[model samples]
Target: MAVQANFENIASYLQQFSHDRSIPPLEKWNPDYCGEMDLVIKANGEWWHEGRPIRRQKMVDLFAKILWKEQDDYFLKTPVEKIKIQVEDAPLLISAVDQVEIDGKQYLQMTTQNQDVFVIDAEHPIYMRAFDGEMRPYVKVRYELEALVQRNVFYHLVNYGELYDEPNCTCLKLHSGDAQFTLCM
Candidate 1:
């Protein structure tokens, strides 16, 4: 199928699943690879198509819902088709962070650029990885997909972290609910 026709079909087919905030069951979807799309998610969290930035927030949000990852590649999947896309860094970006208390327990909540919110816990723990020669923080969003914690959000999160002295090195420890993450280990 041509790229434009396929793109419109995918968008229209996915519209039904976009009404609510729940994510589509991409894991259960087994579609044939429909070649590649000229879609590139840049390291800075901008979605570009062809050579121009995709300025439509709604379209970006809809596409984010269908994002799937296999091995090291990313794809936009529908019920019948899957198109590979390029990702310079992590597919999503953690745009904001907040510390919320519930029943006297603290939890770190992260919001992605697409407005997907998740708590930092065992299910979505933050980890350090080397990106562009610097160790940066990332949190798992869902289905093996991760969001690169923005630098400003990372700094804001640091305020809620405490210093811990490991046996070999000192690390920054962040506690959220029952999960504890040690950074710079």
Candidate 2:
């Protein structure tokens, strides 16, 4: 899935000072595209897809409650955004970009449905070189992602007012809850 996917333009748009045909591709500003994976979740319940009985609701709710609400990374509490499912059909992508926004912008988020999601074991060398400040491994990337997500979600939850309050979340805890004491609920 990583090799056969698309980049949703999260990076700042590329700039070409001038269309110099003599310019080498490597010399020109070009950013490698990052691949994404999607998940399609289903449960054992009566669902009316175009009008058909598919998986049950219990299964869907189970995923949402356990992985998502329970705050499981690679599940929901991860850095993923714009999660939607192609319900009532033989599994499809559900676009959730109509509402969610980040840094005054809206973008498509990567996700995996109907499959057990896994984080990449190491960070891309390019990310390390570009982002600079932090030396993040693949596992660390997920935490950093979740940290960004935590901030955005925190702000959104606050604006919605539906959520009165939220607990403090950090990137370190999301990576590997080894010997460190995370601010647990």
Model 2 TM-score relative to the real fold: 0.17
lDDT per residue as tens, model 1, 22-120: 888999999999998889999999999888999998889999999999999999998899999999999999999999997889999999999999899
Off by over 4 Å in 2: 1-54, 67-95, 109-185
- Point to the candidate with the largest TM-score: 1
For model 2, residues 133-163, the per-residue Cα lDDT tens digits are 5332121212222211222332332232222
- Residue 117 lDDT in candidate 2: 31
- Candidate 1 overall Cα lDDT vs. reference? 0.91
